[model samples]
Target: MSTPLIPLTLLLILTAVLVESQSIIPIRYDGFVYKKRAASTGTVLIEAFYDPVCPDSRDSWAPLKQAVDYYGTNVVSLIVHTFPLPYHDNAFVTSRALHIVNDLNVSATYHLLDAFFKHQEQFYNAQTLGMSREAVLDQVIGFASSTLGNSFKSAIKSGFNDSKTGTKTRVSFKYGCSRGVYGTPFFFVNGFLVPFNDDDTIDYNGWRKLIDPLITKKQHYPSNIF
Candidate 1:
């Protein structure tokens, strides 16, 4: 008697779930800010959706870091959102490792990122072909602990599936998806996605041209010019 109603009810429930998900927003703290700006008024936000094991992301990281370092944290707030690509064998483990680092020791977040970039090849598909996920996770944990410390190692032993760190990692990836990022090394500046084109592949000089004008404009021109 209720078979027809059951199918219609399921459809309505699924639609409501999607609507709720759409209403959710990504918060600023969803990603760990590597270079923090003290104030928001004139700060330029440089956000990266990066896969830790992705080669393109590794290449993009250097110039991005250099640019942010040159600009100083005062002017640029660089936030790295780890968008772990599924095809990468151990990217999720490494991505979760970052959230764990950010959770336990916010200051060592960059150190963990550097460690991952430094040893990226080890976690590649060929290298980790026969390795189980737990083994890869162990390797990641040890690597992170080495970069951070024994104390962090203790905390992170179970942090991957722990509520807070796991949720943070998941949220960062979800936020990247919601922003329409389909690949590693995607970037956003001031909440606007950087369009795909020749200039999208940015170098230090490229970033300077992009950032300098904005800085100068903010300094000289008043906000709300109209």
Candidate 2:
């Protein structure tokens, strides 16, 4: 009997293939940027690919936020790309929810992102094992309502069910794949994938060591950036 066909994406993941980016012409930082800043302002452009429900992503979130706050938006601007691991049953929906939240409100998206990373366990595989996709989404919508308010619920629900949201979310995933990201919490700084710091745990100080050097004397970071 002929072996069943495996989807290309699954095969790529299984083999740990490095997919080439779709464009050689520098892909734009299209992800949802936090604390947007002007490019010429010499900001540390940070891009991260996070699987919305992944524990590692959750664990890494706080320090990442702290580092950004430490440098302040003047020195750092963060962008998020959700790369939902297909093995995580509800990962896609949660990733899509971020897209929905971003579309509705750029400012609110990060709050929702912060909330998702904070309460991600509520939507984990074990928690949602026997749940229907729609049911889990309802839970997510309710969670958004609590975090983002009741007025956001209907719009969020509609966006969740909309094809456009799914498409945009898929784009995020594909972009991550194209960037050779097979894992959650993969990061890039100034368009290059950042090597993990040797610290037992990364923190604001760890980030300073990584970012400070990038800022040249001419560019110079914020007054209190030290």
Clashes of each: 0, 0
Q: How far is candidate 1 from the true structure (C-alpha RMSD, Å)?
A: 7.9
lDDT of 1 at 164: 71
**Candidate 1 C-alpha error for residue 114, in Å:** 0.9
Reference-based lDDT, each prediction: 0.77, 0.77
lDDT of 1 by residue, 119-202 (tens): 899989999899888788888888888878887888888787687777677677767666766577888888898765632467
lDDT of 1 at 128: 87
Give the poorly placed runs of model 2, Cα more than 4 Å off.
1-9, 13-29, 39-41, 197-201, 217-226
Candidate 2, poorest ten consecutive residues by summed lDDT? 17-26
Q: Estimated TM-score per prediction?
A: 0.84, 0.82
Scanning candidate 1 in windows of ten residues, the lowest lDDT window is 1-10
Instruction: State the lDDT of candidate 2 residue by residue for 189-218, as single tens digits.
Output: 888987673223456777778887887653
